[model samples]
Target: MDVEKLTKALQWRGFTVERFATAAEAADWMDQAIDGVSVGFGGCLTAEQMGLYPRLSAHNRCFWHWQGDSRDDASRSDVYITSVNALAETGELINIDGTGNRVGATLWGPKEVYFVVGRNKVAPDFDAALWRARNVAAPKNAQRLKRKTPCAVRGDRCYDCKSPERICRGLVVLWEKPTAFEKMTVVLIDEDLGL
Candidate 1:
């Protein structure tokens, strides 16, 4: 991936971009950058991969529904951290949510938002990015959550099925840093960290 080009594209769109060679580096940087604040998480495998919760929680009041905290508590926190399903090199960020909490917070809730992205999630363009979100990320997430959707059963691409367990119900595309937020930062890591 063209890290410099992607960085420029993200920067041009008003997002503060931070590049790192590894997930651990990014996580460590974030742990130090944010302190004593209530931090919330959107269902993020990337953060899990980096062992982020424990690192951040040592100093920050962190909430994650995946770890027994309420989703509402997460949404109401001072900062929100999550990963994108797909990131277009053109600078658009894409996320497919089964529950609205993740995308919803990105749109308006937090004082600041941080997206932790790995190289695997970056696509060449908008079309490729959306395709990755729908086909690659969504299906993998279904399997992880054991949702029993067609995509999960098939262990492949998305069927765009009508199954009630479908995890692709809500799609959010960030063309730029959202207007209401104080800031949105994109933490780009070069390794393959998550699905």
Candidate 2:
């Protein structure tokens, strides 16, 4: 991946970009940077890989629906952290959410929003990013959740099925940093951390 180009593009779109050599370094930085605050997390496999919840929870009040916490509880947090399904090297972030709580939190409510993206999540352009989000990330996530969707059963790509268990109900594309958010940071990791 052209890290320099991606970083420039993201910065041009008004996002602060931080590049890391490894997920461990990124996680360590996150742990120290977000100290003494209320941090909320969206359902992110990348964060889990980095062990962010336990690390961040050491110094911050951390909440996540994955831990049986309510989305409403997380919404009131001081900072929100999550990972996107796909990131366009041309400066776009794509995510598919079942409930919209994750996307909604990224858009508003939190004082700061941090996206912890892995190299595998980066695509060449917006279209490719969207495709990755649907075909790559969504299917894997569906399979992981044991959803009855065609994508999960097939264990291949997205069929855009209308199953009630479908998790890809909402699509969000962030082409630029949200003005309403007090701060937005994108941490680019070299390792392939998640789906």
Candidate 3:
């Protein structure tokens, strides 16, 4: 992907884009940038892969559902951290969520939202990004969660199944930064991370 083009596109959409050579560099920078605050975490494999929970929790009052923290409490923190299912190089952010907890917080919750994205999550264009989110990311996540959906079972395209365990029930696309939010930063890591 063209990092320069992607950065310009995202910037035009009012997002702060920060590129990193590695996840470790980004994680260390974030740990130093954020401190002594209430930090919330969405259901993000990228953050988990970065070991953000343990690292940030040491200095910040952090909450994550993965660690038995209440979702409601985590959603109301001073800062929110999550990852998108697929990010368009043209500037669109796509996320397919089941319970809406992850996408919901991005829309309306914390004043500052951080999207920790890896190089693998970037797509060439908006349509490609949406397709990646639906087919690749969703199916992989479903398979990981052991959901009984066709996509998960076959490990292929989305069946758009009506299965009760369907995880791609809701979709969120951020074309630009919402006016209500104070800040939104996209941390682009060169390494592959998450599903």
Candidate 4:
């Protein structure tokens, strides 16, 4: 992947991009960046892989519904942290969310939003990014959740199934930084961290 090109594109599109050699380094940077702030976490495997919940919770009021915390409260936090399913090198971010909370918070209602993206999530272009989200990320997520969706059981690409257990009901493509947000940062990690 052309990391430099991607970083330049993201910057041109008004996103603050920070590249890290590893997820741990990025997590450490995040821990310091959001110190003393009220932080909220969306359902992000990347964040979990980085061990951010415990690190952030030590210094910030961090809420993650995946840990049985209140989703409503997390949505209203001072800052929102999450990961996208795919990030286009051309500067588009693709995310598939089962519930609207993750995408909703990403769109608005936060002072700042931080996206923790691993190198494996980057795609060559927008179409490829969307494809990655649907075919790769979605299936892996469904399998991880132990859902009975066709994608999970079939062990292949998305069938666009009508199963109620589908975790990809909402698709979001963030081409530019939201005008309502005070800041939007994309932390790019070198290692592959999550599905």
Candidate 5:
């Protein structure tokens, strides 16, 4: 996957684009940006994979808990950085959230928003991206959350049933350009992050 192309696409959609070759570069950039910035983190596997939790904590800045966890603080954090399960080449982001905290924050919360994504996160197009979200990200997340959805128990693709435990209801696709805040950056990496 040519991550550079995807990064460009994201930029074309009005997102500040930053490309990093290694995890150190990405974390370093984030560390500098965190100065005087209240930071919010989503329950993203990529953030964990990049060791962002300890990095942020070591910096002594406030952290917000998205899942009512011990570390979340909704009132603070100047910015929020999270990982999406998949993004489309057309510049749409897809993520499945259990408690809607991640999506809610993404919609409107932090002054600035950042999406850290890998090359594998890009789909062929918008339709493919949504399809990947259902068949790939949603089912996997359902299983992880131990939801009672059909796909969760089957341990496979989504059945798209009317199950009350459906975790795919709050699907959001950002097709338009994002408004610029202090900074809305998208960090594109070659390594896979989440899902």
Candidate 6:
């Protein structure tokens, strides 16, 4: 996708955008981005796999995760920082997670949210973002976690099913930039970061 177009569209949708040259720079900013944040992480291999989490972890307290391995404490900290998978050009965030930790935290518990997205996660519109979440994001995650979801078996797209193990159950879209905190920054990197 065209990064400039995507960035412009996101900006119009109400997020403050910062362009980074590389994933390293993105990770660096995330580390120094804030303080005392109750960070919540979605199942983003890009952030975790790229080694961004450790650096961000060093800065402040991570929120208590309702799912995934409980690595950080959630009660003491008031501020929150985290990343999600999908973002539309119109400035809406779309996320699909199995255990609900990713979407759950963003919905109600965070003081602020920071989404670190690479060029790959940008879609033309909200519907396109949803398509990417199901077809591109979900199945790849299923394969990574070794789940038996239909998309995992088909390796094509999401059916939006009633399966108990369906990862796409809780989808949250932030159409307006959140004003709950001092800042809600969406750092846009030119590189490919998440699925």
Per-residue lDDT of model 4, residues 35-142, tens digit only? 888888999999999999999999999899998898778889999999999999999989999988999899878899999999999999999999999999999999
Worst 10 residues of 2 by lDDT: 67-76
lDDT of each: 0.94, 0.92, 0.94, 0.93, 0.75, 0.69
Candidate 2 lDDT (Cα, 0 to 1) = 0.92
Off by over 4 Å in 6: 36-38, 63-79
Residue 104 shift from truth in candidate 1, angstroms: 0.6
Q: Is candidate 3 or candidate 6 better by TM-score?
A: 3
Q: CA shift at 184, candidate 2, in angstroms?
A: 0.7
**Which 10 consecutive residues of model 3 have the lowest summed lDDT?**
70-79
* Poorly placed runs, candidate 2 (over 4 Å): none
Give the total clashing residue pairs for model 4: 0
Instruction: Summarize candidate 3's per-residue lDDT along 1-195 as a digit string, tens digits.
Output: 999999999999999999899999999989998899999999999999999999999999999999999999888999999999999999999999999888999999898999999999999999999999999999999999999999999998999999999998789999999997998999999999987
Q: In candidate 5, how many Å is residue 70 off?
A: 6.9
- Please, what are the lDDT tens digits per residue for candidate 2 over residues 1-195? 889999999999999999899999999899889989998899999999999999999889999999888898787799999999999989998999998999999888999999999999999999999999999999999999998899998988999888999998899999898898888999999999899
> What would the C-alpha RMSD of candidate 4 be, to one decimal place?
0.7
Better of 3 and 4 by lDDT: 3
Worst 10 residues of 5 by lDDT: 67-76
Q: 2 or 5, which is superior by TM-score?
A: 2
Residue by residue across 1-195, what tens digits does model 1's lDDT show?
888899999999999999999888998899899899999999999999999899999999999999999999999889999999999999999999989999999998889999999999999999999999999999999999999899999987999899988888899999999899999999999999889
Runs with alpha carbons beyond 4 Å of true place in candidate 1: none
TM-scores of all models? 0.98, 0.98, 0.99, 0.98, 0.87, 0.83
lDDT of model 4 at position 32: 88
Task: TM-score winner between 3 and 5, please give it.
Answer: 3
lDDT of 3: 0.94
